[model samples]
Target: MNDIAPQVARRVLLLDGAMGTMIQSHHLDEEAYRWQGITAEGSSEILNLTRPEVIAQIHRSYLEAGADIIETNTFCANRINLLEYGLEDHVDIINRRACRIAREEARDRAYVAGVMGPTNHALSLASKLEDPAFRRFDFNDFHASYLEQALLLIEGGVDLFLIETVFDTLVAKSAIIAALDAMERLSVHVPIMVSVTFSDASRRTLSGQSLASFIETMAPFPLFSLGLNCSTGPEEMIDLIQEMSETSPF
Candidate 1:
């Protein structure tokens, strides 16, 4: 574990709240959101460039508000997500710049956890109805895209990586694999935290895998922590969290 990860177990760390809510408070128009025609609406990652001052201000606000960890505003900086805005070519720089901005603001005051969102697209789905088991992007394709983003994030000086808001197991597996590969290739190890979204009271993912099963599937990877996020209120998640605490290794 990184210095920060150990403390997570021993103490309560306050993470900053939603990034979009903070950004929306700025009232930035389309020009600011687009940042020179490189990003589309609903994609906040580009704020790191066009409105970096805004991003920095938000980070400072969270830190002032007593957040222990500030995540980079690069949730969609990966190749898979960036492709939605025609940003496939700028993947490396986008992620690096976002992490750099957060690192500067954090400045040893807090940990900068790189935020990697689940890429909702599927690779193993076919275009034609004739074959259902076809793939537009295979496992290697998913691995390479995630590896590229992870490398840049590490180079940009994040204290750790947070694979968050994950709904699909396949994509989560790909991200975990890519992160491991990135650490090996870069020769730098950082603690990784995995968070999955719950479908409902069942404590299963949208794909219908139980929390215990999710843990089982992800057991091969060394994760600093694994828990739930999104699609549920506290009343629904309490039992699930308790279940994970009793079942999970980390």
Candidate 2:
């Protein structure tokens, strides 16, 4: 994987649209995701190992569509999220395989951004508003899980890391740190792009942090870019994104 900073600095880069949505269009059944006689239906990450061709096809389509970047199908591939389906132990293989599939299809046509999604749990949010401090997982847990995922993603040859669709600033912070830590340990470096989601026009993270706070919280890191992703349509997000550009130093 090479540093994309120069190219990113030159012009606006186009990233492919939703991977899960495109996968759903195929309407694959439980058998498509089955591996080792165990069926983990709806887990797209497993498709990299069991059905690499399918993942490859999706990458090809996006590249053919003029996307400068195609994300590896590894979102929610982390141990914490995979535990719900009992596929936690297969995290490394799944992530590595996903990158291989994406890299093969990309083949110098586009950069492969390793997609690390926010896990199902949050470090701050709880079921009730009153229990603001109550969390099922802690910061260290998030960091460790992200570290394991980041290490293999780097080993698998991702051009950059996309810690995207973050709902919790705390979670994004953990991922950012883990990615940097992974690079230090492996003696390899790649740019990281962070994209957060605003719950609404309120312009606040789901965990209740204001956009300014989110920018302030992430300011210390040498991020490749900071922007918005899910949670609203373009018309609704334009102002927020413009505000981000004005407020963010990235």
Candidate 3:
């Protein structure tokens, strides 16, 4: 769990691809996405509970394909996003089960990366600082939701955390804070990887922060690795990554 970047860099460390995208390839409909009492849009995280064998199969595919790190299917398992599906009560169930499945699949051969993605309620904008007129989930809100997921993932046996697809630095901060707190409570420390998404060709986050600003904003955290994902193809990312490599301390 410690110095994971060095460990990963030691060999051909392969990370599993998109959980949502792979799930969609199954062609599962709303019925496969339903909760006991809630009507729904589509939520990929629910598959861990509703169709666990499928999730295990996904993890097995990556591991069998020689993956070094397998991310749990808990991308939208946080409380804020569960509210959108009216399954806020099932956050613990979703995340815990997802981690357990990944852990069981990975066994001793690979690492299980506890996945945390941005919520529908952006703590940056929803709890607007410059504009108090807008408010919902603030920094505290993000902290609680993230801490809940982190604790469960750790409990379910994960080696590290992957706070991926973060569009706002504050949102990532909240997850980092929660991770620190969760580790303190559990009396165990694990590595954390932070990845962000860009809006377009601007090389800036959707929150309007430049790549440098984003790096500066996240500089204080004890991250295992900080990089980009979900936007800007490999051609553009290579250049951006070179700049970040020269600039980033974590």
Candidate 4:
């Protein structure tokens, strides 16, 4: 992974677009995502171990297209989310290998961003709008899951961490805390980039926080960057990006 701070200081950095989108373009079937008699068809993360060349090719394509940062193929590789595919036990291998694939493909041409996505569940009360009090996992549970994944990403040699597709601020908070803790324990320091996803065109997270509120909540974290991703396209995001620039210190 290259030094990202200097690059950020110089000019605008082009982070690669959707990993899921690029993977989908390949049209991999169920067999492609399977390994050791375990078939996790929709789990793209499985390809990091089963079909690394597929992931490496995607990274290469983005780099060739002039992307500055190559995000890993570990979006849903966390233990909690992988449980859905009965892959709870392969979390470490999945995350570490994903990073390795991205890093090898990136070489010194681009940075490898360890992508940490929000899990299938959320800790925010409003996640269950009808039952605002319901909770599938608490902050501690989320923190632990992120911590385990973060540690492996670090060990796998990512240049930085990208907590992306965040629909819940609480989930983002947990991920940030877990990343910090993982760095401390591993004696490493890496920049953290966060990209929040609006639930809709409302410019608010699914947890029901406005962009302003989200900025205020995440203000204390030492984030490398805080901005928007997912939910909408450029036309809809223009105003939101302008608004974020005005309110966010990052």
Candidate 5:
């Protein structure tokens, strides 16, 4: 999988469009998939739980749409997110199923990007300081959770790790470190890509760091690629990508 990336580098890679938008198109009434456990019976987000075949069909649709990279339908597969709806136990099952569905559909033509989103726990200074139990916000806890998810994704045969919609730099850093640790433990060397979400008012991440700072912080890591995702829209993202490209060292 790592070798395939270089061969495809000559051409621009096309990632599938928004997953939320696609999910919403199906008319599910759930607030979000994080808590609803798309696989849970009778849950509005049951497409992930009950209608995974439908989800895999969606991946096939994207592939037919000319996407070079197809992300798994497991953005909220981590324990932190699943814990919201008491579905934490299904974390491994959900992530594994997502990768399996994607791999089955993608076969050998497209790349399977294991999708991960931000933690459900807020990372704002105010939130942390207010919670007495917050202590120091242990990176180890974050690392263990992400490592669990990454190992499942890798075991399911994902081609790469796609950490997207990150707002907190600390959490994002922890996730990257967790991914690295997981690779070392599993003895697998797959590429990773990290992206952040931004607010409309400010171009910076939720933590107030500019994209340049985020890129610089992650520069030491062996990232196959990096960019922004799930903020504003394509028009705004295009501007951000252009700005990032001009300033980015890579």
Candidate 6:
């Protein structure tokens, strides 16, 4: 199947707005849904687990909102995050359901962006530069977790993968590599998009890398698109986009 993302990226793609904001508007209560799988009997996270219909409805709302790309609710659907809620066994189910819901909601009107957010693991520059000792976790563990999610999303017929809200470039690199590796393994030629969240003050990723450095570091990857998302208002995001447009290879 031909990938539609390359064409979309060439234009000014309109990604859906803040997910947390939209969810909050639902008044599900933050602590309740945030800790869903573990605390609440059928936590809001379990919406994918129990009420996938509701999830699809949310996706449809974004499409109606004029979003060219609608991300799946699987942002925190990875094994690590699921495990926190004692729902590790539901990782595959949750991710796959998320993709299915998004696909159903799009109805060919919009593209489904399989969402992958940062892992619960802590990321620090000293940890990245410090070698094995500084690092608190093993690379294999990290790769396996992400690879599982990416593979499932692809299998579920997601149009593209979006690695977003990344802070440390090192961790972001791990996610990028994992997704690429999964695509290679599955022989699925889906496009991948990587977006990092910047700190409020300097507008740089948590690893202290400038936008230029981030672009340079991610240049080798076969990314169909690269941009910033989350943790910034429209004005800051606009400036960051302009800076990236000037510096990025495009």
TM-scores for all candidates?
Answer: 0.91, 0.95, 0.93, 0.96, 0.87, 0.87
Over 4 Å off, model 2: 127-133
Expressed as tens digits, the lDDT of each residue in 121-158 for candidate 4 is: 98775447788888878899899999999999999999
Residue 162, candidate 5: how far off, in angstroms? Answer: 0.3
Cα lDDT of model 2 by residue, 1-250, tens digit: 8668888789988999999989999888878878987788878888888888888899888888999999999999999998877899999899989988989888877899999999878976784578767777789989999999999999999999999999988888899999999999999888999999988878788889888898999999999888788877789998888889899999
Which residue pairs in candidate 6 have backbone atoms (N, alpha carbon, C) closer than 3 angstroms, thus clashing? Answer: 36-43
- Regions of candidate 5 where Cα sits further than 4 Å from its true position: 29-46, 128-137
In candidate 6, which residue ranges exceed 4 Å CA deviation?
9-11, 29-44, 123-136
lDDT of 1 by residue, 90-185 (tens): 887788789878888898788999888877576433535697776667778888888898888888888888999877788888888888889999
Q: Report the Cα lDDT for candidate 2.
A: 0.89
Candidate 6 lDDT at 184 equals: 92
Candidate 3 regions off by >4 Å? Answer: 1-6, 126-132
Judged by TM-score relative to the true structure, which candidate is superior, 1 or 3? 3
What tens digits encode model 5's per-residue C-alpha lDDT throughout 1-250? 4355785668778888777677657775434333443334332222466567678878888999999889988777777766665677887777877888888888888888888777656544334656645634466777777889988888988888999998887788788888888899989898888888887847887778888888888788888777888778788888789988897765
Pick the winner on lDDT between candidates 4 and 6. 4
In model 2, residue pairs whose N, Cα or C atoms come closer than 3 Å (at least 3 residues apart or on different chains), thus clashing, are: none
Cα lDDT, all candidates: 0.83, 0.89, 0.85, 0.89, 0.76, 0.76
lDDT comparing candidate 1 with the true structure: 0.83
Residue 142, candidate 5: alpha-carbon lDDT: 71
lDDT of 3 by residue, 155-228 (tens): 88888999999898888999999998999999998899999888788888887888899999888888888888
